[model samples]
Target: MDEVVRRDVEHAHGDTRMISALAAPRRTSAGPAVLLLHDAFGLSDDMLRIAHDLARLGFPVLAADVWGDRTLPTTQEEIGPLIGSMVSNRSRWTARLDAALAAAADQPEVDPEQVVALGYCFGGSSALELLRTGGRLRGAVSIHGGLDLLEPDADWSAADPEAHVLVCTGADDPMATAEHRAALESGLRRAGVDWEIDLYSDTRHAFTSPHAKNSPTPDAVAYHPRSAARSWAATTRFLTELFPTVRPVEH
Candidate 1:
């Protein structure tokens, strides 16, 4: 595995604040890059680990802190309200997400033209928002993220054809139910966007988070190792398809 170098940097869009973690393979030339968005709970250890893992795979990964410098929500009780606040102000949230993407693309070790936006849960929906809003991205990936379009009536006729999308989610995830998936698919299709969705059966919300197993709402959110591994493998494959010139580090 390649040694990963990482750092925290401040970023923002207007008044919305952000603290992003940037990670990349040491001693290697810059190749592709990914803008990683955290879940509703904020940028957790698991999120950082995934960023490093992707960095080791030869991509410069930037994990954006949507919550700014505020204390991260550690419990379900705290998480809902924090996420709700951000979601309520959809425009501001989207602008902050764009700022994160721009910051990642501006990194010295990132190939600006090959940058992609990726997110988990709340962040996942943000990735799709980038595409819906016509951000200049090679692709976008959503991991166990919400699928509903925040602004259902917003125009998507001008969506970029170059921006491919991949969504991985638990089949039984209450947050991303079958109805939600259908609605998202319909919207994407109507916009003529290139996209694919992978559903892991028997899995629920937060299936990719190791910490989910310890959550009080086990039935709604819990880690499933098999689903997590499968989703990750699919994500890498999706990335490879989009950025074929970028090679993974050999073990």
Candidate 2:
């Protein structure tokens, strides 16, 4: 049996206490490592499940904590402040993500050269930010994340030529406006970056997460199983091409 294990890899979350940064469940296979960033929901059970799922795919996943081990926000009102703090100070949070990536690469099972950063909603954007600002990743996958930047937009001329990006976004996602997609498309193209953006019609924000549907804007964020499956399929193909050392296990 390819049993997936979870262990708390020590990573500083801007404090003395060791936070959960690595979750690499190894068997006999190896491919690319995944550095996962959580959404505003803050390292919930759903996030851990994602790590286990990735482990089954023959990939080691390091699900990083954006906020140091803290109680999950009960309401969006609480969530807003948490996310706002990170976005407002992008440099500090991005540094935290950088640290997590370093930890992921240091794992015995992970190939440092083949590490990929992935995120959902807030996490998706965070992954993109890491790559945009010189985080050495083979690829970055963003699932339903708003691409609008609080900082100045990325100068594609400076991007790493080998870095690839996959964006799975809902056509009707209010937060991820068409303007934002257009701008991102323009930048990736101008920079000569290998990137693909898949727009899922009739889908809204957080299509991959059932828990997001309960947010304040229910109409703007609903779970779309079809889109979720499709996006994951795309991600699987993209990652396989980027890191084809191991075959994915049966889902």
Report the lDDT tens digits of candidate 2 across residue range 139-218: 89999986764243657665577899999999999888888898888878877789999999999999999786666676
Off by over 4 Å in 1: 27-29, 148-154
- TM-scores for candidates 1 onward, in order: 0.92, 0.91
Full-model lDDT for every candidate? 0.81, 0.80
Model 2 scores what on Cα lDDT? 0.80
Residue by residue across 95-214, what tens digits does model 1's lDDT show? 777788888877888888888888888888888887788777888888988765355455666568767889999988888888888777777888878999999999988888766888
Predicted structure 1: lDDT: 0.81
Clashing pairs in 2: none
